[model samples]
Target: MSAFARSFLKKSLLAASTLLLGMPALAEEAASASLSNPFICRRPSGAAGTITEFPLPTEESSPTSITVGPDLNLWFTQTGTGTIGRMTRDGAVTEFPLPTEYSIPQKITPGFDGNLWFTQLGVNQVGRITPKGVVTEFPLPSAGSSPYGIAAGLDGNLWFTQVTGNRIGRITPAGVVTEFPLPTPEAQPTAIALGAGGKLWFTEVRGNKVGAIATDGTLTEYTVPTANAGPSSITLGWDGAMWFTEQFAGKIGRIGADGTITEYALPDANSGPVDITVGPDGALWFVELRGNRVGRITVSGALTEYDVPTAGSQPAGIVFAPPGFLCVDPHLWFTERGSNQLGRIRAVTVP
Candidate 1:
């Protein structure tokens, strides 16, 4: 546990004792309350936005990654159930099964070919699904590469991380595949994103570093400041820098085009921030798997967090939709891995 968490627990115990000494009835209520506060994301009437959730039709589906499709619908991976789920704006859900059983699909993104692509760790293949729900699969160059995170590159191809392959893999829209070896072995990369300057950036969770690959395939890696930080997600921030989450260290990290890295500690050092994205309001938003809350941070380092309505939701992935871009209700979307639900906070546009 972080020192802050230990200290907070100690103080809470002392305060509870004081309350129990005077008022037994009141002390019972206090004792039953959770140590950390939980709130459904909401603001005055229609100000910040209210949170809404849609439960999946199947149990233990374990949805992992979520993305807004070119069709303006939400697409997600059901790792547990081995299916791809699509939800309309009104919460109507449809599921499509992968061709291979035990596919163990991971992160997903809209591809340059007007389709959505995802990683299949269990079957060791890259899968694609058209907007019409047709499925296609391509095997990785090597066996058991464990392709995890994927993103559309500036070169009209898809780029993804090979968690165990120790290399970056790219697949063209035509299904031709190529692999680029990483200088560092066993990096265990987890998530990827297209960042500033048309470069594809990814997290090296085990290597404790962040790497960038130009469309031409030249790769460069920058070391994170903290040891064993376990960076988990990467995104292109509104400020023209690459922002990411340090899951192990409970910090939000930033890397500039020049490869300079900066880190900011969260209010709750044990929050275990997972996936991050750029919100419609131009701030960086992230999911706190351990904190059970969604956090927002500004370019200047100021932070704010809103608790998930479902206790122990264990939010795993997050994505942002711009106001009126495709539909009337723009939202900050996420997957509730623990609760088996998809969630969204109503989005407010900044004039």
Candidate 2:
């Protein structure tokens, strides 16, 4: 066999041996107990596996969103502790608290200005954090806006969703703020993504629709076929379309650039799909908060799931570690909300 296949086989056999020996303790404490050997191959082929329970220092941190920062270190938001965290590829971690009390930081993304930007759900504000951990907060014009999802826009500004304000917002790197009201009041716009043609697409949890807003503030909305689908998070697919999760309807929906809509039902009932991103392998990967599993879905509608070793772990945000900064093998890193750990999925391939 080839070198790659031989290495795969060796790992597979070793994992099988451990399971056959009934070493449940090893699996349970694999990550927290040992940082050097945090990886545990869960599949028989060893081609795909998960590293569970990678302990975060702060207990009950309740990490929400994760992204590869400009510095190439993994940065995430700790909702429970009201802080932002940075983790090195080698597993070292550091956290920075938001200046505003009870800010409830949400999604995070690297801004074009070489800094990290995030949303503050509890207080009506958007925040910017430098690589050196200097944080600055900008208050939204509307009170109780509750901004949730955020993304760097092509217009050199950050676009975000206002869940409580029922609007879309834009903030320049200089902190200038602007807002556009959605036609349907109380639509509860949850997630936002940069769509084709420099437009912004987002999900309306209560309004049961997907909407797009241009850089100049032109808004267009499309109704999802299922009522009260509760669309939560959205990301641009490898196919250049917008793919989103239906948290309440238990389905994944795709919206074409031409405004065509397609919905695929999840095989597992009530999985409660929360966050999604395009994986390193070019498939759409997502977290099932209630179902406690990591799932992958292809553009052609194929679905596969990897069970998280910790039951009720409530896996949250996910992102592919940037190339060359970490291991050669592509890995998907995520947060285990209930367990207060960082999870890793290595060697993921199209099966």
Candidate 3:
């Protein structure tokens, strides 16, 4: 088997062994060996293979991106309500409204500073929220940057994308900010993730490419073979590759560290898969906004999809609880943008 397939094979076998033998499982869930492991595979414990949804307290809160916060609860962006929300697995929730009006926060990630940080796409800024629910907003130096995706970097900083500004942004914990211009103007860099070699990897939807940048501001870009693929969100796979969604192409694209790119077609031609995240079993899971389903795909390209209970809920982000959480009742939590609800696939249903 190819190295990519082997990566999936090892995790798949472990999942099966766990279900049948009732034994504990340990699977490495890191993208780059240089980075510390974030999440791990464990025997899933729950009632059954099912999905549950929790409605947001406010109307049209529009939960966008989700992450396992430092406190081991779920945190997400409420684009409509302009609030950052925290929710327990049991469906309890508390919201910290952003001070900025109509901020339209997009992607969120747990910061190394014991807080959650996110992008304010509408305001061209990044916002930080402490564990206690205090929020601080930091504006980008360049106006009209349209900051979108945000991820924590290995070097103790938060990195983000500028969909219109066409620049990659880095911000220190103290709120100091820096921007690097992409070689390809109008790349419309949408999402960012920490990838192999401690470089920050991101997707260029308009540029039809994926790119990586060293912490020192060195830049590199790789053209996706399929033109206008509209590569949206990106996540580092267990195979040491960067996997992303081709929103316009209706496919998933994997780019190796060497920049060799491969694309896999989803089962539905128009599923509109947007956000992706590494699951506990080492397989990648993503949200299909138009199809209203969550998809699980192995590194080898095999796929199994689970439908959302609410039709046209427009599931947005998918994230597994971090390793710090109690793994017994782990879940792959996601947001339902169209439904104003937070949802999750029971651990038992995940691969």
Candidate 4:
């Protein structure tokens, strides 16, 4: 095996062993309270056409995925720190360390039971954190599942994708886990999103297909038009279609409920598009990891790009903070994995 592949395997095995053996508590006190004051950077012009960056207290936090909690706070996973973090709209940041070391938390989502559910890829478990900061964990039945993406399902449960295990899993509010195997072997399912008509849509990064699984466990797969397009993330679009990012092919794709697929190539070649979501302004927004830009794609396939202020930021996740308790208008929240910061793009104009 190549040296790079060997090193990756060694790290994966070490992480799994750490999760299996467990580790001493690192920051038990921080779990129930906020951390130190955050380093907030706000633009002078206020929310209109402004971008803010908030640095996490812990260095190399490596925030991977973010979701708006039910309490209107931003909840995200710190992959490098092995902790779950919460940040208020005003920039108060709190971190809750996971019980298992090297769990490598990935995507986080608000559960229907008034808590946040996240994937622990290294430990092969799913974690739950309450609004008040209490945490609980549930283990998957299969080892080495490597759960990546998670979202609240229409049936009052949480659905997630197992990239290594090549399956879709559902966990109830009570923490019962049931996994469904994918039709194609080794598809490496990555991100998942709840679709219209009470179904869950997901991406098969290795199989180059988009899949739909009913709440009842019925599965259907649709092949992307491009070969090895590397569909990485999937989201529900404003126009009632399922939209996704093609990371390797540098394109955005749309699939109808009836299985018709359409592809739109990005303006920049080799952009490495990753996560995508529907913005509050009725347009689709995404992150370009390689291109160092955030993107907007209209329902009609019109694409526009906005550059991140930090060079080589490697933005990974994007979500919209709707107008509510702390926000006067909707703002886009993203994670700068390369820069170790939380970023916001506010008052964006849709073309």
Residue pairs in steric clash, candidate 3?
A: none
Q: Kindly list the per-residue Cα lDDT of model 1 for residues 32-96, writing each as its tens digit.
A: 33312221111223545467788899999998899977665789999999899998755679999
Per-model lDDT = 0.82, 0.82, 0.82, 0.83
Worst 10 residues of 3 by lDDT: 29-38
Q: What tens digits encode model 2's per-residue C-alpha lDDT throughout 1-351?
A: 335434433443353344334333232222343333324322222356556468899999998899877665789999999999999857899999999999999999877677889999999999999888999999999999999999988777999999989999999999999999999989999999987788999999999999999999999999999888998889988678999999998898999988888998988759999999877566788889988888888999898888888888899898865433112234789988898888988635322
Q: Which stretches of candidate 1 lie over 4 Å from their true place?
A: 1-45, 322-330, 347-351
**Per-residue lDDT of candidate 3, residues 91-202 (tens digit):** 5799988888988888898877778899988888889998899888898899999999988887888999999999999999999999999999888999999997899999
Give the clashing residue pairs of candidate 4, or none: none
What TM-score goes with each of the models? 0.85, 0.85, 0.86, 0.85
lDDT of 2: 0.82
Put down candidate 4 lDDT per residue, 1-351, tens digits, no spaces: 335434433443343343234322112222332322122122223433356778889999899898877666889999999999998856789999999999999999876677889999999999999988999999999999999999888688899999999999999988899999999999999999989898999999999999999999999999999999999999988678999999999999999999999999998869999999877556789999999888888899888788889888889999876233211234689999999998888644322
Local lDDT at 149 for model 2: 95
Candidate 1 TM-score to native? 0.85
The top-ranked prediction according to lDDT is 4
Worst 10 residues of 4 by lDDT: 35-44
Model 4 lDDT on a 0 to 1 scale: 0.83
Instruction: Return the TM-score for candidate 4, rounded to 2 decimals.
Output: 0.85
